[model samples]
Target chain A: DVKVTQSSRYLVKRTGEKVFLECVQDMDHENMFWYRQDPGLGLRLIYFSYDVKMKEKGDIPEGYSVSREKKERFSLILESASTNQTSMYLCASSSVKGGYKEQYFGPGTRLTVT
Target chain B: SQQGEEDPQALSIQEGENATMNCSYKTSINNLQWYRQNSGRGLVHLILIRSNEREKHSGRLRVTLDTSKKSSSLLITASRAADTASYFCATFIIQGAQKLVFGQGTRLTINP
Candidate 1:
């Protein structure tokens, strides 16, 4: 079984503070992604990384950035957390070997920016 | 912008009944996937259907894809209370290293 683990299930931060959410996958997948899910908005991609130190912006990349220093770990950074940034952040990883290899997701990190 | 959108944002059904959710996408896709997420939990991949294929099934779940309409439907047979969760349809577009775009998802409630 594939296991994707997130650094935190719940976190709180003050406005303008820097925040980091970490994700680690045990399956050695080549693709990793960060998304923020909101009611009526669903899961909007923030960033994705296909290889070490490589990153790509998704539809809603503003106010968010990501890092993939190693294959197993992917990090999402908020330069200046704001109340509007509060959301359920999800981490997912997938293998690109076959056509649409399913993505495995980690238990989301619910960040509250106060 | 979200590529896919799910209809009937919320659904309720009896335990023995079947639950169905529909998703529509904006662009061409190589394949479509369905995932289940219990409230505040990680998502679990349920099934995937390629653009060339019309329908696919796994256990009690059935998925159908229509390329012309750029839509898909997921059906859960004999749904149980445990099946209550959010069902999302995701598609892998043919562009830009093939990123997966997810829909808003349908919140399903299976009452016992």
Candidate 2:
């Protein structure tokens, strides 16, 4: 079975602070994504990485950045955390080599920006 | 903007009853998928149906897609309490690495 792991399950940060969320996958997938979930708004993509050192912006990428220095790890960075940024963060990974590749997700991290 | 929209934002049913949810997309898609999230946690993939296919099933779940209308429906037969969760439909576009666009989601509550 494929497994995706997140660095933290819950986090709290003060406003204007820097925050980092990490994700790692053991399946060696080529596609990795970051998403935020909010009530009524559904899930919005923040950023995605297709390969090492490659990144792409999704629907809502403002105030967020991503790093993919290695194939197994992806990091989401919040340069200046704000109260509006408090939400559930999810990480997913997928492979491009197969038919109808499904994404595997991590448990998610609930962040509270004070 | 969201590419897909799910109707009946919330649903309630008793055990052993059938539950159906509808999703409509704005653009052409290569495939559509169903996922379940429990209490704002990570999403678990349930099923995926390609554009060429009309219907697909796994276990007690059935999915149908209509390309002409650009809509899809998911049916859970004899739903159990364990099936209670938030359901989302995601559309996979044909271009740009096939990024998935998700819908607003439907909250399903099943009573025992």
Candidate 3:
């Protein structure tokens, strides 16, 4: 079974504070993704990494950055968090072998930017 | 913009009844996948149907895809209360690196 783990299940940060959400996968998957879920918006992609040191911006990448220094770890960074940034952040990883690979997800981190 | 849109944003059904949800996508897709998320939890991959396939089933779940209409439907037979969750349809676009574009999702409630 594949396992994806996040650093925190819940987090609170003041406005303008820097925040980091970490995700690690044990399946050695080549693709990793970051998404934010909001009511009526579904899950919007923030960023994704296809390989180590390779990153791509998804539909909504504003105010967010990503790091993929290693294959197993992906990190989402908010340079200066704002109240509008509060959301349920999700991380997912998938292998590159299949045409339509299933993405395994980590328990989301609910971030509250106050 | 979201690539897929789920119809009947919310649904309620009693146990032992079948529930169906529909999803429509705007662009060409390599494949369509279904995911379920319980309240406050991460999504679980339910099923996937490629563009060339019309229907697939696993356990009590059935998925149908219509490429001509760019639509798909998920049917849960004999839904149990545990089936209550938000169901999302995600598409693997024909152009991208297999990144999934997700729909807003349909909230399903199963009454016991």
Candidate 4:
């Protein structure tokens, strides 16, 4: 079974603070992604990494950056958190071997920016 | 921007009844997939149907895809209380590399 684990289930931070969300997958998948889910807006992609040290910006990557220094670890960084950035963060990983594989998601990190 | 949109943002039905959720996407997709998320939890993949396939079934779940209409439907037969969750339809666009565009999920409630 594939397992994805997030660094935190809940977090609180003040405005202008730098926040980091971590995700690790045990399946050694090649693809990893970060997304923020909000009410009504649903899940919006923040960033994705396909290989070690290789990352690509997603639809909503303005205030976020990602790091993939290791194959199994992906990190999402908020340079300077804001009130609007308070939302549930989800991490997912998948294998790209056989076309598009099913994404396995972590429990999610609910960040509260005050 | 979201590529897929689910209809009837919320649904409620009896435990024994069947529940169906529809998703519509704006662009051509390589494949469409459905996922379920419990309250405040991460998503679990339910099923996936390619653009060339019309219908697919797994366990008590059935999924149908219509390329012409650019839509898909997920039907959970004889729904159980455990099936209560948010169902989301995600699309992998043909041109998008390993990126999935997700829809605003449909929240399902099973009345026991």
Clashing pairs in 3: none
Name the regions of candidate 3 deviating beyond 4 angstroms: B96-98
Candidate 4 residue lDDT tens string, B8-77? 7999999999999999998888899999999999999999999899999999999999999998999999
Each model's TM-score, in the order given?
Answer: 0.96, 0.97, 0.98, 0.97
lDDT of model 3 at position A68: 98
DockQ-based class of model 3: high
TM-score of chain B of each: 0.96, 0.95, 0.96, 0.96
TM-score of predicted chain B, candidate 4: 0.96
Any runs in candidate 1 off by more than 4 Å, and if so which? none
Residue B96's lDDT within candidate 2 is: 64
True lDDT of residue A55, candidate 1? 96
Interface root mean square deviation of every model, in Å? 0.8, 1.2, 0.6, 0.6
In the range A1-114, model 2's lDDT, one tens digit per residue, is 989999999999999999999999999899999999988898899999999999999989999999999999999999999999999999999998866657889999999999
* Pairs of colliding residues, candidate 2: none
DockQ list for all candidates: 0.89, 0.77, 0.87, 0.91
Q: How would you encode candidate 3's per-residue C-alpha lDDT over A38-87 as one tens digit per residue?
A: 99999999999999999999989999999999999999999999999999
Instruction: Specify the highest-DockQ model's number.
Output: 4
Positional deviation of B18 in candidate 1, in angstroms? 1.1
lDDT of each: 0.92, 0.94, 0.95, 0.94
